[model samples]
Target: MDDDIPTRMFYAGRRWQVTDMPTRIRDSVWATEPGTGRGFYGWRFQATDETGESFVFDVYPGAEGWHVHHCYA
Candidate 1:
């Protein structure tokens, strides 16, 4: 992330450029089944691309690193 904004993202073997600051930034956490001592944290955003198309993108922290979980066009 650059200046709290995603500058680029990869999806479907291609890279998409984030042209504007993300809107509606949200965060959440989910508990795992039955006291497994595990949970998941997520961050979601609605942003526009350089081509003027809108998309929903998500990023989550995992054991390894931050990952792009999903993208909706």
Candidate 2:
């Protein structure tokens, strides 16, 4: 008595599983938490892509500013 049952089953059969790999740079949130005034003063790291391309990221609080960490290959 339910014509909508067949339509719902058709879409459920085509869903696939996710199999992507994780990044090596391993980014994370390093900001000051709520109700707190002190946290990571500065943080930096060099990241390499899957193709061996390298890049850097530097994070600092307030007026410190960001700078490249530098990397090879």
Which is the leading candidate under TM-score?
Answer: 1
- On lDDT, the candidate that comes out on top is 1
For residues 1-73, could you state the per-residue lDDT of candidate 1 as single tens digits? 6775566766555566765556533232445554564666655666565556777777776898767777777
TM value for model 1: 0.49
Residues 1-73, candidate 2: write the lDDT tens digits: 0231111111112321212221222123443564455444433344444444444434343554332233233
Candidate 2: which stretches are off by over 4 Å? Answer: 1-40, 60-73
Candidate 1 off by > 4 Å: 23-41, 46-54
Q: Evaluate residue 49 in candidate 2 and report its C-alpha lDDT on the 0 to 100 scale.
A: 42
Count of residue pairs whose backbone atoms collide, per candidate: 0, 0
